[model samples]
Target: MAFWTYMLRCVDGHYYVGHTDDLDARIAGHQSGLIGGYTQKRRPVKLVWWQEFPSRAEALAAERQIKGWSRAKKQALIAGDWESISRLARSRSCR
Candidate 1:
């Protein structure tokens, strides 16, 4: 089974990051508010992005990394703009 790192864009326009072994089930729970957390209150979230990893640890690590990103960086990622993502990272470091 592959582990997944996923991002949800909530109705409030905020993003939530998480890692799970059962991606579909997890997303379903979030959508139904059965998950009962950040996503639950932010209901009607859309699955904006997701990537599968070979291990849970890797997925968790990716989740943590994304959670720290700025909204712009996350948007760049969602748009699959790697160049913009890299530029944003460099700009951050130079600050």
Candidate 2:
């Protein structure tokens, strides 16, 4: 079974990162407010990015790593700007 690391652009303009075995169903739950917590109140989210992983552990790891990233980093990711993502990571580490 495939797992996924996904990012959602919330209606409030914030991003939410999560891992799921069922991308479609999970996204539907979030859209319908069936999934609680951060995304629940920030309903009406849009799937902006996602990556498939061979294992749930890898997907979860990606989700956790992304969750710790700054908004700029996340935006770079959503935009598929690998150069900017690398630059941002380097700059962040130098801080």
Candidate 3:
């Protein structure tokens, strides 16, 4: 089965990161507010980015890593700006 690490742009303009085995169903749940928690309160989220992984562990790891990233880094990722992601990582570590 394919697992996915996904990012959602919430109604409040915040990002939500998560991993799921069923990306479509999970996203549907969030859209309908059927999945309670952070996303439930910030309904009407749009899937800004996602990546499929061969294993759930890898997807989960990606989700966790993304959740810790700064907003600028996440935006860089959404824009597929690997150079900026790298630069941001290096800059962050130097601080």
Candidate 4:
């Protein structure tokens, strides 16, 4: 089965990241508040970005990676600006 890592733009103007094997059902649950948690509390989320992975491990890794990104980087990612995203990523100080 294909695993997907998705990013949601919540009504509160915040972002949510998650991984699932069923993208459609998962997004539906978030929209309907059937999954009561961060996204549910924020409610009425819209999909901003998503990536498909061949393995669950890859999906989970990507989810974690995206979650740690700065808001500017995340926005760049959602905007599909690979150049800016990579530039922001490299600009971060490891210290």
**lDDT of all the models against the reference?**
0.96, 0.97, 0.98, 0.94
Judge candidate 4 at residue 76 and give its lDDT.
95
Misplaced by over 4 Å in model 3 are none
lDDT of 2 by residue, 59-81 (tens): 99999999999999999999999
Q: lDDT tens string, model 4, 43-62?
A: 88999999999999999999
lDDT of 1 by residue, 1-95 (tens): 79999999999999999999999999999999999879999999999999999999999999999999999999999999999999999999999
Instruction: Return the TM-score for each candidate structure.
Output: 0.98, 0.98, 0.98, 0.95
Q: After superposing candidate 1, which stretches have Cα over 4 Å from the reference?
A: none
Model 4 TM-score relative to the real fold: 0.95
Worst 10 residues of 1 by lDDT: 36-45
Model 4 bad stretches (over 4 Å): none
lDDT of 3 by residue, 1-95 (tens): 99999999999999999999999999999999999999999989999999999999999999999999999999999999999999999999999
Looking at model 4, residue 90 earns an lDDT score of 80
Would you list the rank order by lDDT, best first?
3, 2, 1, 4
Q: Which 10-residue span in candidate 2 carries the lowest summed lDDT?
A: 35-44
- As for candidate 1, its clashing pairs are none
Estimate candidate 3's alpha-carbon lDDT, on a 0 to 1 scale.
0.98
